[model samples]
Target: MPERKLTPNEVSYSAAISACEKVGRWQLALKLLDTMPQISIVPNAVSFNAAISACEKGGQWEMALSLLRQMPHVKISPNTITYSAAISACEKGGQWQLAFSLLNLMPEMTISQNAVSYNAAISACEKGGQWQLALSLLSNMLGIGLSLDGTTSGAALSACEQVSAWQPALALLDNMLSSQLLPNGLHAGSAASSLRKALGDSAAYELLDKLRELWEDNSNSNSNNNYNNYNNNSNNNKQPWEDSNNNNKQPEVRLWEAGQPVDQQLAVPPEALAAVFDVLSDVPGVIAIFKPSGVTTEEAVNELSQQLARQRHVSESVDLHIVSRLDHPTSGVLPLALGAVGSTAANWLEAQFAGRLVRKEYVCLCEGPSLGLTGCQGNVSTPLHTVELDGGRASRTEVSPIGRQAFTGYEVLAGYMPPLSSEPLLPSHDGEPGATGHADEQRPEGPELMLLRVRPLTGRTHQIRVHLASIGRPLVGDLTYGAKEASVLSSCPRLFLHARRIELRDLAGKPFVAEAELPHELEEVLAQLQQVAETSPEDGHQS
Candidate 1:
């Protein structure tokens, strides 16, 4: 450059100061501030603020602090822009303490940190995974004479969602609602689906019903307005009333369809459960429930006959377990659960007589393909048959490839561990808890693994256990499904099989869905998997 000529205008001075600040030339920026006076120009508030920002952006926090003190010396007062910018720069430098100090020093006239100011600080905390800190900042933003806009809450909620913190994520959504922050489609979908999974059937139905109501109200408003316009036009033009009637009818039908409530929970209360048995007995299109026990056949017959009589279904007897439908061999039983009185006693007899149960399904955690023969990955392409403990009931199960349209889906939770800690677990169908019966089959050593999220579409007695075992993938600690493997999983403690979800149609052909979560034992096993995955990198497990 041919020796630079100086322009002494205020605009010229401000631009030079900005250029110095942009390039981290804090010393040069300060020099320019001082040099302005010698040029018969005074340092304005704009230039002073620029010099302070430069010091902060250049990592000179101390110099930035000192420059603020000199602002009054130069007869320039700091505005919100200057204060906010200084705080933001400190935010960028990870100097939150200094940023907060400066924020407190600002004019105590109920200052509000604009969107830009709070976002920078929150973003920094998020980058550091300081979730608690980030949350505190958000509360302070709202509590200290400020309200959070959609963007701030959205950022915080997104962090919570990513961490799978189900409850907090839900609360944030609720808070944003008070701000009238309408959730975009993606957020609504995620929040609804998550609420469904975490809160279960009742909550899921409530969310879906609320969504339906919202859409319904919108449609109804539109319908009412349309009908009003139609009626007005018909009256003014003397058009046919029939045309208006038809138009109104179409909209009313549409509104009703849109407004349908999703569901009503059919959960049987513990006390009303006897009422369920009453339904079983009284349901139409049924014959007498059949049950057989050697010693008490007469009493059993009398009581079951009375149960069926109360229901008004014909009373008869067959050597079987009473059930709604007995479409399959194992269909009549109460899931081999032995929850009924006495093992293989009078109640088991009723299951055999009902003869109306359609299907059965099982939920089991089979090893993934990575486990080779032991994993759920490979297909056996063969059927397997095993004898029952009674040596009288022969059980058979089949395995095929996990088909795409089979309606059976398994979501691998992507981790493994011993099934559960040594805490006492649930009882078995035989009225005894775990580690009973085989007594000698407990494993001596080694970690056991449990898969997650196994769901079955069709019900077949012992279907889940039998099918999984056919492919050499036994459940972690299933005594019946894989007796030998129970020992293998002895270290895991809990049986990894859970009846996660059941889907079927009622007698009226309407669909029904029920689900149960993993028991505490399984949860403990998953906790172990997480710990192992965290501590051991060579395993290369990413969860």
Candidate 2:
């Protein structure tokens, strides 16, 4: 039988061009587009759109514009999709001016501009560092009564992040929450990025904690109501947190204290000392403490300073400065400096961090069975960077490649495969008051637990969390990154990371080391896991 070659028509050619576009073969797409005329098939708007999209994905800005310009010559009218793809091509190619020009031309061509068109233009502005222009577009959209979605808000946040405009970023975040729009990873990341630039590391972390608390309060209330409504008609109407096996057990009180103003919160009570912190070492000019989870490093420093003053009979003038910081939910060793040491000691301590002279070691319970990780010991050097999103727009934080060169070395201490629980978990990022998530699509399959000893070679914002998530093993109880739903299923109530050891040198280059044991929450979680294993050895399988 002789095989016959079917003639390529508009539909077939459009599909071929679309296939090429998906795979980012712009050149082939263009070739296929040109071949349509040779085969006597007049290219339609769909064909041009697919070709332009291919160029957009391939970063072929000029070719995309050329294809768009040629659309009219071929007697094909460019629609909004055609123009939007062309604009996106310019956006990706850093051709903001051209993108704006195309946007302006839409009105003259009697084509009404939509949110997609404006998003592309705003995104182009963001890429080009024209945040003012991007913001203007957003304001204009609102003036014209265009309803903003996550994408639109995300783009605006990204624009604010580009310029390190923390005030605007915070304002936008507050607006999103007040409007009951969910704040996803991008939204939080961008605001955090701006805050880090404006308020330094510790304050930024504290601010994020406050924001997350507000969102959680709102989300929990709304989600609980929704859950009650969902199960109202069922015979076994129950709260989501109620476990079947532990039906009779009293609800476990979460250790995470609701955040309060540092001024209003009283000094660390003597009876609550263990729950607050463990003093690792107290030297003349430096102090180290094991900060408990749930409290910001700044709050810990403030309270601990007062405690030190009372114990040593020193005046409050002995100003304490945070020499090392940990995320709010991260419990671990934190080093501080006494102001009496003056700027010399402060500069020296800061130098150690800047030069990576200090050794930071952490232990974390990550979501992994440790399979296909290559070995028990390995290093991850994934470029950790921030991304900002508003509405539907996104832009990477202006971290240079060099700035993002974060590195972490890890050794898997133990691997335990826990059975997947059939618990119905709420989305971790369900921060909006009224927004809901689709059922858990983040269930882990096999070995659901891994213990790792980690040493960060280079420090960046969320470096350890980012690195672990990049390697498919996000930390337990991490709402950000990929561990959201998994964290909900785990018994750990906070990010399962602890800064256990720190090695550094004091003034005059004298070497020293400080270590802190795991906090009560972390230790208790581990003890529970051990008890479970003791009772049910068949429950866990080695990965």
The top-ranked prediction according to lDDT is 2
Q: Give residue 367's error in model 2 in angstroms.
A: 35
* Residues 301-323, model 1: lDDT tens digits: 34544543455444542222333
Quantify all predictions' global Cα lDDT against the true fold: 0.44, 0.65
How do the residues 188-248 of candidate 2 rate in per-residue lDDT, one tens digit apiece?
6666666566555544444444433433343345542321111123325432223455362
Off by over 4 Å in 2: 1-6, 222-543
TM-score of each: 0.32, 0.45
lDDT of 1: 0.44
